[model samples]
Target chain A: MSEHGERSAPGKGLVNGLAVTLKTMTRRSTTQQYPDVQPELPPRSRGVIALLEENCTVCMLCARECPDWCIYIDSHKEEVVVPGAARARQRNVLDRFDIDFSLCMYCGICIEVCPFDALHWSPEFEYSELDVLDLLHDKDRLGAWMPTVPPPPAHDVLGEPSKEEATAARKAAGPGAPTAARTARARPETPEPGK
Target chain B: MPLWLDLLVRVVAVVAAFLVLPLLVGQAEHKVMAHMQGRLGPMYAGAFHGWAQLVADGVKFVQKEDITPRDADRRVFQLAPVVALFPYLIVLLAIPLGPGGLVAQPLDVGLFFVLAVLGIGVVAVLMSAWASANKYSLLGGLRGAAQLLGYELPLVLAAASVAMAAGTLSLPGIVEAWSPWWLLWQAPAALVFFVSGLAEIRRPPFDMPIADSELVFGYMTEYTGLRFAFFLLAEYVGIIVIAALTTVLFLGGWHGPAAEHLGWLWTLLKVFAVSFVIIWLRVSYPRLREDQLQRLCWLVLVPVALAQLVLTAAVKVAL
Candidate 1:
């Protein structure tokens, strides 16, 4: 027998017997109580999709890259001639851009591929439905801004600033100012138009 | 009430206490670990630090779909958790938690009865492992059986020493004999008993059978839903029972500072204190390797327990 074996052998029976009790007494647990204190998800976690309609240029890029084929876009071409332009330019009018979120895997590829920076991840994960089709988000439904994902509470066990403090700090810094370095670091590189 | 009705009531009491106490202790273990590790534990489930978290977990387990592997022995796999759980309940019947705390006839062989019943839990573990027909489960089951065999001798020896010192196998009678407490007279036996008890439960350092990293829950590998929950419940219940047993055997069952005057509260406090110590040890140490585990039990614990037994006999003859 090995030194560890020899040393622990006579005592092996006792230790083996006490092992379970010792474990119950020891070991890091896996449970996190969610109702009284919400668990903190990591930064850049893809939860739900929120459309930033103001930033949308009706580019239909999100619809094209979606692997799930959940996004639906319908457009009509309208010709408008500029007074000084040599030729008339055709701008596609966005008639419909419906994203059926029911099929969305939250891969964020659509958000990444959107040239207009229209799609963003919303932190709300509590969406529940009686019907499957209720999750099928249409153009008008997708255009609405989701509720701001609650910032990590100050007392949060996962170690992030509370939502109130983060919001207050952001407000102090000015509207749309970078809230934290971590969040700023996660920002995707904006795509150039007409690529 | 009629004899059968009274027996039914006692059974219900034992079952209820066994179920509830483990949940409380499990929560306390989490809270204690969190405090020791410089973090607050379970502050969210209900009002005070996720007190209702276990209830939520129980509800979730009930709601989950109980799934069995297609290749598994369905009857045995389903029966395993019940087997694992039932022994703890049976063991609880013999435990004298306080002066009037026992739910069953306090047998002259109470100490042996608890140990014997606890042994059955290992069998359940083996059954589950074999029934699951999974490699991990088989390994886990095998480890559990081997572990029990290795640990039981020392555990029995330690209990025998305590029994010899107390001059009775009846748990209540033993408690009655200790003027100050049995632990003071039999410190060595207490130490051996505690160490062996920890092993018997397959606790940390020796928790190789269900080591999640290696075995992925061992015997419970193929179990899902409520079946998995039952296994977990059995483990926690086992922890509580061991702690309770420790309190009863050596710590002077319900005897504390003015315990007689304070009534059952003193007993509760003593049990809680013992339970907390068990939890504290878990937070303080990391796990031991498997071979190291086997060696430690056989080499160190067995000799120490035997020595204690011999010394107790010598002391008894001298007295």
Candidate 2:
């Protein structure tokens, strides 16, 4: 009993506690009954790391920034044939990208440091594995989580439009508007030949 | 019936009760405690409110590795669980569930026998404590012994007051002598006996010996597997024994409406109701500290028990 508990008439607190528990016993339990009923997680809830493979430039920024060194990346430089260029330009082609989820602290550093906007947070968390080694999610497996990734929540303060959105807005304004590329920073070129 | 056959039947009945009632109380505790805390306790095991949860626990306990400490007195350490478990089995025999020779073994001095046998639990605590060669175990054992010693006086005194009111020590005889007015007359002694009985069984508020926070399960720290399971079974059996005894002694055992035909039912209902109260008390009160435990036993319970004794004596003489 605390000092306050002592000041109440002796045994009154004991009776009151018993009454509280008895009353609680009659009320509906607050249990969520997980597995039977899915939880109502917020839209941007960080359940797992998802990958947008098409957006990855094989920059290795995410791998370098990962504190746990759980991320693995492998890429080889390939010559790209431009439609009308004198010299062929070289670009990094992604071969392998895997995240060892067993070692991941889920610090979001990998997602934050990715300049290509490849990594995203997905709310589909129920991917438990029987073996620890199986937790290492390859790029294909990570990409599978992309469909479950919810769109980013609307900003609390709608301050600055993203370059893509701003470019779209300019294009909509007039036919003689400045080209979208000049209006915004230069767009990163896609390495793949087919659209 | 042949005497041997009769004895065998009674023994079997007692043994079956000894095995079953404790499990029921344990399951009740699991559900009751959960609901009281606003949680759906166990939902998965039996597919129906976790009815087989304790059954699964029993299987798990059996599958666990029985570890014996290398430095421990292996013989005494192993024997402790048996000692802890068997006294309640013996005490259960004399508890009359209803009228007309309904008891398993109707002893003339059933109250004395029950009280004396229940005292052996402290020996079990001491055995496990000293045998484990752990300092915490020893401290818990010492605390258990001290608590039991302090509270035993009131427990016995309260029972004795009831014995005086009935003018007999036979449980069924006491029940036969009981009247509804005894509810008001013996209320104080009933309160003392029930509380002291809680202390005897080391139930919470009175559970200083096994203070998990301070003592790491006290005398049971080194126990594992089936040996540990035995100790848990012993605790549930202790609850049943206490509830049954409180029912038999104070609540007029099987004396209720339609008790002639449903005497045993009345006894069982009373026992389960008392057992629920025991669980409620555990849920309600934080454990009393050691000094508070002693003070409650000596200053409060003992005096109340003594006063009930005097009142019973005076009423008996005047009537």
Candidate 3:
């Protein structure tokens, strides 16, 4: 913001400005019709938290680790008789799972802390509610958002296989496959170039 | 044609043009300004490129609640919008769309009539500013007065140069005497007139009085609903008036090829073309600071306009 700048010609800046606007007038306008046309969000963009109800094992890790204290979980013990033994085994059955979206800070701590792959980010954000209470997504409502969760983006070309992919590959190789500890010791650590 | 019937038809046509053309310019401003800034402006009003956006706006303005401040002067405050708007209608009547007595009223001193009537618009600004009982409104009104004082000289002087060149004060007479070469001859006065006209109307870059960020719409701060709509309508009419005046005086109104048969069409085409430039200017420039605005008027526009007047005189004397 110079008050006065050296100019070779008077009104040159004014002419330049007019030329710029005229050029812009001929260019295509960059406006998107949001309601008439759905936007193309990035792959795996964070829009809303979704739940995989079947994958949830009644673990309280997500609820406990939530920074906003927005997640709620409740469960009851269920007794199941063993097939060929007199002893009975007690297991937890999920009775309630809710996320108070109105209070949720969307910090993603709950999804990160979940022991099981029970929560995912869905790129479907048009869930506005008239009442705050309506924003408290119950298990059924959270589960509905799961379908909108996009597949994770591809890793870099030179990146290592993901943990899940690696695990699955190792399983497919059978019992005779190289063990994790054996492979680690088999690859000798190379000395630094300077050393 | 019968004289009374002919007068009646002309009046009706002028009134129709007065009502419609401003709205058309307003709509063009919306679309043009939008595209200049890389946005689609009002794409859904008429369902096809927002042709009826201003019409829809008029309906919306009708539905709004009109409010009068408790401390305001009730009568004058209520009357301000009409005062602002009515003069342009009078000015429009004197403007000729073509040759052969195509004007609504055809005043003998049409240039004087137009300039005089255009001056009355600022009175409405003063009335609204004084009556609104608001500080911002008062500041805006005072600024409008100052702007008028500064710009009016150049505006009139530039127009006077053209009137001298044509050797007539009537708008149609000016057009009838116009030659294509006057485009170059009258170029300086044309620039001065157009710039001053823009300032007089308080269009952007000269919109210090109603600098929305500072004055909250200036003299129109307290206006709402249909009254406010009238002010908006007046602003658009001002643009049309200025553009038409510029066209008539400098651009050779209704003087294109085949102008005898298609004279009104040429006039309208020129008017819209000038209006587009007005909108283009608004999109291009930021509002000038108050001091800078005055400086441009007093230092630049006035001197150039005076030089142009002398040139016009010298050319007239030699001829």
Best by lDDT: 2
What is the CA-based DockQ of model 2? 0.67
The whole-model C-alpha lDDT of candidate 2 against the native structure comes to 0.91
Q: What is the lDDT of residue B21 in candidate 2?
A: 94
Give the TM-score (vs. native) of candidate 2. 0.81
> Which candidate wins on TM-score?
3
What range of 10 consecutive residues in model 3 chain A has the weakest lDDT sum? A186-195
Q: Which residue pairs show backbone clashes in model 3?
A: none
**lDDT tens readout by residue for model 1, A106-159:** 888998897776777766666667898888776566656445544433574444
Instruction: Calculate DockQ per candidate and list them.
Output: 0.04, 0.67, 0.77
- Tens digits of per-residue lDDT for model 3 on B1-319? 9999998998899889989999899999999999999999998988999898999999999999999999999999999999999999999999899878878888779999899999997899899999999999999999999998889999999999999999999899999999999999999999999999999888998898899999999999999999999999999999999999999999999999898888999999999999999999999999999999989999999999999999999999999
Candidate 1 iRMSD, 1 decimal: 7.2
Better of 2 and 3 by TM-score: 3
Task: Indicate the residue-level lDDT of A83 in model 1.
Answer: 91
Candidate 3: docking tier: medium
All candidates: TM-score: 0.64, 0.81, 0.90
Candidate 2 deviant stretches above 4 angstroms:
A1-6, A31-37, A53-119, A128-138, A151-195, B63-78
**Model 1 complex DockQ against the native:** 0.04
Give the DockQ-based CAPRI class for model 2.
medium
> Residue B224 in model 3: shift from native, Å?
2.3
Residue A30 error, candidate 2, Å? 4.0
